[model samples]
Target chain A: MAIKHQQPDLVPLFIRYVGAVSSKLSRIHGIAGRDLEIKLGNDGVIVQIGINAEYSHKVVPDGERWTSEWGVTYEGMRGISQPVDHPLKEPDVSGYIWPDPHKPERMAEIKQAMARYHSDYAVMVDLSCTFLEAGYAHLRGMEKFMMDLHLSRDFACQVLDGLNTYYTALGVHAIEQGIDIIRIGDDIAGQNGMLVPPKLWRELVKPRMESMIHAFRKANPNIIVKYHSCGDFSAIIPDLIDLGVDFIGTMQPCGQQVDMAAIKAKYGDKLAFLGGLDTQQLLPNGSPEEVREAVKDVLRSYAPGGGYVFMPGHYVNLDVPLENVWALLSAVHDYRRYPLNFD
Target chain B: MEISTQDGERSMAEIMKSGTLEKLAQAVLEGAAEDAKRLTEKALSESLPPNTVLVEGLSAGMTVVGGLFRRNEMFIPEVLLSARAMRFGMEVLRPLLAETGAKPVGKVILGTVAGDLHDIGKDIVHMMLEGAGFQVFNLGINVEAHKFIEAFQEHKAPVIALSALLSTTMPQQKAVIEAFEKAGLRGEVKILIGGAPVTQEYADKIGADGFAPDAASAVLKAKELLGIS
Candidate 1:
C-alpha cells in the first residue's frame, strides 16, 4: 500500500501520477490512441487522437454538445476564447476536460490510453491542472495569467468556476474507478506568498473549490484529496483544513513561509502531508548529505505524527539528479517512522 | 497582562526602554488589542512622548513580531493583527507627533505593478512600513508604470517598491524602473521588487536595488536600500 499501515521497516515507494503526456509511451502499456497529440487553440473544440488519427476525423460527445471530428482550426473550437477579461491575452481551449464518460466506447478508449501511462505504486491523477488556468493562459497568455487573476477577477472567476465543475466531475469518476489519491496540483504561489490576494481568492476561487472538496468528502470519506499550492500560504491552512482536505501536497520548503515543523505541529492530526523536500534549491543544487540532512529535519518534524508521506515539493524536475531522487527516497524508506527524532 | 514599571518612579522614557514596553509589544504581537490600547494609554498618561511610545513601545513590539515574520516563526495573519495593534497606537500618536515635524522615518511608494492586480502582499507591506514609521502611498492593484513615476514625483518618496505576482506582469517592474529613469529620477529613489517568480538574482538582473521574498524582508530591505542605518 502507498500509505503506511503498521510500523514498517521502510516507507512505501510511491510515485504521484502526473497528467497524461502526449509524447511517446515507453512501451510499458500499448498505445491506445491513434493520434497522440491533444491540442487546444484559441477556439473551443479540443482535438485528441492516436498518432494515426491525425488525418482521420472522429465524432465525439463533449459535455452538452456532440463534437464530431473535433476541429483543429481556431474558429471550429468555441469555449470562452481569448480569456474573458484581460488584454494582452489568448485562451487555451485544450486543457483536460473529461470527455463524456457516459459513452461507454469512448470511455473505454480513454481508459485504454490512460492504462498506457499507469503505474503500480501510483494512480495517475494530477487534478490541479484545471481548464480555468488554461482559459486564462489562452486569454492573457501564460505570462500574465497570475496577474490577470488580480487585474480581471470577474473573468478569472468565470473561468475558474467552469474548470472547478469539470474537475469535480472528473474527480468523482476517477474515485469510482478506485484511484487512491487525487493529485490536485496548481501553482497558486510561485516563490513568494500568493499570486492573488487571499481576500480576492476567498471571494472568487475558494468558495467554489471548497464546495467541490466538501462534495468529494461526502461522496467518499476514505479517498484522500491531496492539494498543492506553492510558496507561503501560511495564512490559509485553517481554510484548507476546514474545507475537508485530507492531505496537503507538495510542501515546498524554499519558497513561501511554510515551516514543516510548525505545520506538522499545527495540522498533522487533521491532514496528511506529502512532498516536503526542497526540490527547487536542494534537490537540483545540493549534494547527497544535504538532501539527507534536510530530509532528516523534515522527518523529525513531520513523520513523528504518522501522517506524513514523502515526495519532492513538486514534479521531480527533469534537471534533478537520479541520485538525489534515490537519496531522498532512501532516507524516507530507511529513516522515517512514528518516533522520528533527530537531536 | 499588566506591565510592571521599573523601580518605583522611573521616567516614562526609561520605563519604555525597559521590559514594560516589551510587555506592551508582546500584547500587540499576540493581537491583544484591548490590552494594547490600555497599556499604551498608561504609557501616555505616564507622560511618554507620543513618538517614544511609538518608537519604543509600538515599533519595538512590531519589530520583534516582524522578526518572527522573517524567521517564518509567524505567518501573515499573525503579523497583520500585530500591525493592526500598531496602527491603533499610531492613531494615538499621529496628531501629537505632527507638532514635532517628526516626519515619518521615511516615505515609501508601494503598489502591485502594472498588469498585476493582487494586493495582499502590497497591503501587508504598506501596514509594516507604516508601522515602522515610513509614510506609504498605496496605488492599489494594476497600477500603471506612469502612476508610480507620478507618485514618486508627488510623494518625493525615497523608496519605491514594485509588486508582481505573475511572470507576465513581471516586465512591468522594468517599465516602472524605466519610467524613473526617463524622468531623471532613477538614482534619486531606491527600487525594490517582489512576487512569486521574483528572486534576488532576478531583482539584481532587473536593476532593482533589492529583492525580498516576503513582506518582513521587504522592511529590512527597505531600511538597507535607503541606507537608513
Candidate 2:
C-alpha cells in the first residue's frame, strides 16, 4: 500500500541489523534467528542469496580467511566478512568460472522463508552486490575495476554481462517463487556522490540492470523492485524510476539526501522510500531520547500521505546501543500510524 | 635550438612560449599518461632541470586538477586519471630529482586504520599528496596502530593521515591516536583523520589534529598542518 501511495495501518518497518547487533538482541530476547527479527519489530525478512550473502551476511571467525564460490577471499572482522582478495587480477574474464546460480540449494533459504513468513510479512530476495559492486568488490578490486572502466571498457562490459546473465536467471527464479520484493543493489555511490560518473554508470551498468528488471518483471510484473545503494545516488533515482523501480532504499542522509523533506516532496509520488534515519551518528552515538526524537522527526518528514518505510540508513552495526535500538522501534510504533500526529 | 632562459620572470615566459612544459601540464590535465610520459621525456631531453619539469609541468597540472575537484567540476575517476598521469611523469623524474637532492615539500605517512580494508579513499589521498609534492609513506589497508607508529619512526614524517570507512572500524582511528599518545609521540606529529563516516567532530573527539572530507581537502589540510604555504 505504501508503494501504491496509500497509507497502511502504520508505516511498515524493515530494519536490518548486522551480525553482532542481531546476536546481541537475540541474547537479550532468549531467541535466535527469525524470531529475534520479529521480536525486534521487523515488518519484513530478507533472504540474501548471492555474492551479497557471502560477502556481507556470512560471519567468519576472526583471524580466519575463507574463499567464496566465486573465488574471492574474505576475512572475518567484527561479525562481518570483508573481501580481502578479488579473483580477477586483470581485465580478462575468459578463464573465470562463475558460481552456478541455477543450483537448487540456492533457493532453499528463500523457500523456507516463504513458507514461514510469506503469509504475514514481506519476503525480499536480496541479489545485491549485484553488478558494479560485484565487479569491483568481488571479481576485480576497486582500483582495478574502476581503472578498467576507463582503460578496458570491453572487458568491464564482459564482466558486467556475466554478472547480469547470472543474476537475471537467479532473480527470475526467485520471482517465480512469488517473493514480495526483489532487492538489487550496489555501492556505486559514496557519501558525497556517484563513485562512477553518471554517464559511465548509464553506459555500463544501466542497460544490464534494465534487462535484469525486464526479466524480473516478465516473471512477475507485480513484484516490487527495490533499488538500494549505501550513499547518495539521487543522481540515478530518476533513472531507477524509469527502469520500473517501485521502491528505493537506504536513502542515507548525506549530500543531496540531507534534505529529506525536499527529496520526499520531489519523488514521493513516483517512489516509496525506506531507510532515512542516520546510522552514522544518531543510532550509535546519540542518547535514547535523541534517537526517539529523531525517529519521530523522520516519520513526520517521510510518512505523510504514505510512501515511506521506516529504517535506519544502513544496517544497525555493533556500534549502536541496545537502548537506541529500543528507542528506534518504540518511536516508530508511536509515530508510524496513518495521519501521523507528533503531538 | 639552445634555450638558455633559466632565471625568474623571463624563464617562465620562455617556457610558456616554448609550450613543452605547458603541453606536459595539459597532458596531465587530460589524463593522457603516454602523452605525459612522452612530454616528460621531451622536457628532460631539452635539458630542463628535473625540479623544473616537476614544479612547472606535473605539479602545475595537479594544482588545476585539485581546484577543479574542489569546485566539483571533476570527480574521483577523472582526478584519479590525472593522478595516474602525474605518476607517469614522476616515474621519469624521481631518480633525477634524487640526484639533484631536490627535497619534497615535506614527508607524510598515510594509512587506513586497523581492521578497515577500504583503501580507495586513502589511495586517493596518497596520490593527491604525492601530486602536491609530499613524500608519502602509504602503509596500505588494514594497517595496525603499531605499524603506523613504526612507519612514523622510520620516516619521521611530521603528519599522519588515517582513513576509516566503516563505523565499526572508525574506533580504530581513536585506538591509533591512543597508541601514539601511549608511545609519547603524540606531541611530535599532527594526525589527520577522514573517511565516509568521519567528521570534524569525530576528529576532535579522537584528538586528531585535523579532519578532511575528501582527497582535495586532505591536501590542503596536510599543508596547513605542516605549515606549508
Candidate 3:
C-alpha cells in the first residue's frame, strides 16, 4: 500500500535556525579555542569572559605526523594530534562552563546576552555542560569538581538545578525580549542510543529539563521549547512530549532503527521534528546532488506538516564540504509549496 | 514380537518424514515467533529434546534470517523481531538444558566502553547473542577497563564485545583491550568492537579480534570466532 502523505494548512513556513551564518537576528555564534573562561562566582551568578582567539591550531609541528596509537604519546602532548584526539573535535562544542547562579550580577550579564539575541523569532543559547564533557573531565580527574550524576545525586542535582535555573532565566529573559523559541541542547545519546538508562534519565536528567521548559512556559506561555538529543530515543518520546518539549533536534537518520516517517506519524502533532538529514554520510562524503536529494527526502517525509524543521543530524563537522552545506541551504530556499502542495 | 513393534515405529517415522523441523525453522526466520513457538511446542510435546528444538527449529530459522541480514536483503527491525522471537523460544529451553549441565552453546561478555555511556548497540548485540544460543553477561554502559577486566576474570568469558558510539570513547575500547593484553588474557578472549563511527579498518587497526557492522553479524562473528559450526 502506498503511504498517504498529509499536508498542513500553512504554506511555506519560514522556520528560523541557529548555526546558519546569516544576517538573521538569532544565528548561532561560536567562541572557539581556550581563550574563553566561565566560572561559578561565590555569589552564585554566572560570568563569561570571552578571550581573543590566539591561534586556530593548538599544536606546533616538529617534523612528526600525529598518530593516536596504543600506548602512544600522551594526548595533547606532542606531534600533530589525530582528528579524534583534537580538543576542537571533542563532543562538547561549548568552550566553557557557566558562572554560578547565586551571583545576581553574573546572572544579569547572561540575561543581558539573552535579551540581545531574543526577538520575535526563536533564539538559541547553547550551554556548555554535557555528560560527555563531564565524563571526559572525570577521566582527566575532574570528577570531584564536575557534576557526577551517577554517584552523587545531590551534587548532580545542585549543578543541573543551577544550570536549568540559568537556562530558564535566559529563556524568560528571551521571552521578555520578544523571542518566540528557546532551544536547549544536551547530548544525551550516543550513535546507538542513550548513554544512560531511560530510568536514570527520568530520575536525573528529565526533571532539570522539565524545570527549564516549565519555567520558560511560565514566562511566555506561547514560547516554543526545543531540546536536542542525538541517536535513537524511541523509548522516551512519550516522556519528552509529556514534559512539554515543543521540538526535538539532532535526529540521526542512519542510527539503529530510526525511521523519520514513523517518528513524524507518532509525534508530529505533540512535538515538532528537527534535524533529519544525515550529517555523518551526506554532509561529509556525499556530492551536492546527494545532499539535495537527502534534503528533499527529509522534506517529503516529515515536512508535509507545519511541525517539521530541517537541519543536519548534528553540527556540520569542519571536514564537511562547503558545497554540500550550500546544497542543503539551497534546497531549503528553493523548496516551494506548489505542485506537491505540502505546507 | 519386538521386531514387529520396531517395524511399526519405522512406519510411523516414515509417515512424519516431511521435515517439520525445517518448516518451523522457516517460520522463525520470517520473524514469526508466535508461529514458531506454537509449532515448536507441538514438536516439543512429542518428546523432542530441547536441543533438537533449538538446532532444527529456532537456530535453523535464525541461520536463514542471519544470512539474509548479511546480504542486506533484510533490514534491522525485521532482523531484530526475528531475533526476539528466537530468544523467546530459547528462554523456554534455557533452564531445562542447564539442568543437564549443558552450558550455553557459546559465551559472551558485552559492555559500552568507559567514557562512553551508549548502550543501544550493546543491548542489541546482547539480544542477538542470546538468540544465537550464547550466554551473555552485560556490564551496562560507561564500563571501565577494570570492570571489564574483573568481569572477564570472573566469567572467563571467551568472547568480549566492546561498544562505543563516540570517537573519544572508541579509544577507551583500546584501553580495555590493552588491559586484557597486560593480564596476558588478550589472546584467550576474542574481542569484538562496534558502534556508529566504527569500521572494520578501525577494529583491525586497534588489533580487535573481530568487527561487526550490525547486531546480526555480531552473532555470526561470535560463532565463527568460537568455531561454532
Candidate 4:
C-alpha cells in the first residue's frame, strides 16, 4: 500500500547488508544475506544480477586483480571492488567496446529473482553504478575522470551518454519482468554536499536520469523509480523529484539532510524515503537502547504520511555491534505499525 | 637562471598589483587547468618566487574554491576541477622546490579508517592538502589503526587525518585514537577526522584535534594544528 502511496499496515523495511557485514551476519544468524533480510521481516527482496562476472574478462587468482568487460580492473582487498585501472584512461575512444545490455546472461538472474520473489514481496531491480559514476570510476578512473570532466566535456558527455543508453535498456528489460521498483544512481554526493556541482550534474547526469525514468515509465506506467546515493544529497531533493524519482534509498542522514521531518514535509507527498538510521556513529558506537530510540524517531518522523521504508542508511558494515543490528531490525518490527502505536 | 631575492619580491608585488595573481586565482577557482598551468609558467618567467607561486597564486585560488564549497555555492565537480587546476601549477613548482630542499609547511598522514572503502572524501582532502603545501602520505582505503600509527612513526607527521563515510565504521576513529594512546603516540601528533557523519562534536568526543567538513577546511585545520599560517 505504501508503494501505491496509501497508508499500509506497517512501515516496510529494505535491508542492504553487504560484504563483511553479510559474512558476519550469515555466520551469526546461520542464514545468508537475502534469507537473513527475509527472516528479519523485510518487505522487499533485492537480488544482484552478477553481470560483472559474465561481462568481466578472466578471473585471476585470489590475490590478483580482475578486469571487467568495460576494461576497468579492480583489486579485491577492500570491502567493495576498488577500480585500479580504467579502460578509457588514454581517452582512446575508437578501441573501447561498451558491454551488450541486451545479453541474455545478464537478465537471467533478474528473471529468476522476479519468478521467485515477485509474489510475496516487493521485487526491486537494482541497476546501479551506471550513471555518471561508472563513466568515470569504471571507465576512466576517478581522478582522471574529474580531469576529463574539467578538460574534456564533450568526451565525458559521450561516456555518460553511453552509460545512459545501456542502463535505460536494462531498466526497460527489468520493467518487463514485472518488478515493483527499478533502482538506479551512483554515489554522486558526499557527506557535506554534492560531489558533482549541481550545474554539472544537471548538464550531464540529470538529463540522462530523466531520460532513463521516461523509458521505464514508458514501459510500465506504475513502476516505481528508486534512486540511491551514498551521502547527503538533500541539496538536490527538488531536482530528484522533478526527475521522476518516486523513491529514494539509503538516506544517510548527515549534514543538513538530518532534518527528516523537514524533508518529509517538503517532498513526502511525491517521494517515498528509505534508510535513515545513522550507520556511521550511532549503529556502531551507541548502545542498543540508542539504536531502538533512533528507530522510533525515524518512524515518527518519516512514517507519518504514507511513503517511507525502514532500514539502515547504507549497507550495514561489519563493525556494527550485532546487538545494535538486532535492535534496529526488532525495533522496526516492534514500532512500525500505523496508526503508529507510540507509547 | 633564478631571479635575485629582491627582484623576485618586487615581481610578486608587481603581479599582485597588476591583478595577475587574481587571474591565476580565478583560473583555479574556475577549474581551468590549462590556464592555471600557463599562468604559473608566466609568473615563474616573470621571476616570482616558487613559494609565492604556491601560496599567492595557487593556494589563494583553492582557498576561494573551498569557501564557495563550504557555503554550498560550489559543488564537488567544480571543487575537483579547481583542485586539478591547482595541481597543474603545483606540478610546475614541485621539482624546482625539490632541488632547493624547501621544507613543506607540515607533514600529514591520511586515510579512510578501517572497514570503510569510501575514498572520495579522503582523495579530495589529499588533493587539497597537497595544494596547501603539505607533504602528505596517503594510506589508502580500509586503513587499520596500526597502519596509522606506523605511518605516523615513519613520517613523524605532526598531524594524522582519518576519514570514514560509513557510520558503522566511524567508531574505528575512536579505536584509532585509542591505538595512538596505547602506543604512547597520542600527544606526539594531533588527529583530525572528517567524512560523512563526522562532526566537530564527534571529533571532540573522540579526542581528535579538529574536524573538517570538506577539503578546504581540512587544510586550514592542519595549518592551525601545526601553528602555521
A111-176, model 4: which lDDT tens digit per residue? Answer: 787777778988887877866777666787777776677678788888888888888887898788
Tell me the lDDT of candidate 2. 0.89
Best-performing candidate as measured by lDDT: 2
Q: Each candidate's fnat, in order? A: 0.05, 0.45, 0.03, 0.70
Expressed as tens digits, the lDDT of each residue in A228-326 for candidate 1 is: 676656556677777766777667774444578888777777877767777655766679789888888777766663666666675554445657756
Docking class of 1: incorrect
Query: How well is each residue in B25-103 modelled by candidate 4, as lDDT tens digits?
Result: 8899999889999998887777666787788888888878777878778876677888878888888888977877878
When summed lDDT is taken over every stretch of 10 residues in candidate 2 chain A, the lowest stretch is A54-63
- Residue B144: error of model 4 in Å? 5.3
lDDT of 3 by residue, A1-343 (tens): 0011234332232222212222121222233211111110000111221110001123545323443211112223122222222222222324525534334442354465455433322334333333333222221122222223433456555545545655566456555554445666555555555544567668867777777777778887877666666676666778888898777776777544268888888777787777777865567668999888887787777776466655667655544666775676677656634333323
Order of the predicted models by TM-score, top scorer first: 2, 4, 1, 3
Off by over 4 Å in 3: A1-99, A102-121, A128-177, A254-257, A336-343, B1-193, B199-210, B213-229
| A27: Cα error in model 3, Å | 18
Show where candidate 1 strays beyond 4 Å.
A1-224, A232-343, B1-12, B16-20
Relative to the real complex, the DockQ score for model 3 comes to: 0.05
Query: Whose lDDT is higher: candidate 1's or candidate 3's?
Result: 1
Instruction: Tell me, by TM-score, which candidate is best.
Output: 2
Interface RMSD of 4: 2.5
TM-score of each candidate structure, all chains considered together: 0.53, 0.97, 0.49, 0.89
Query: In order, what lDDT does every prediction score?
Result: 0.62, 0.89, 0.60, 0.81
Query: CA lDDT of A227 in candidate 1?
Result: 71
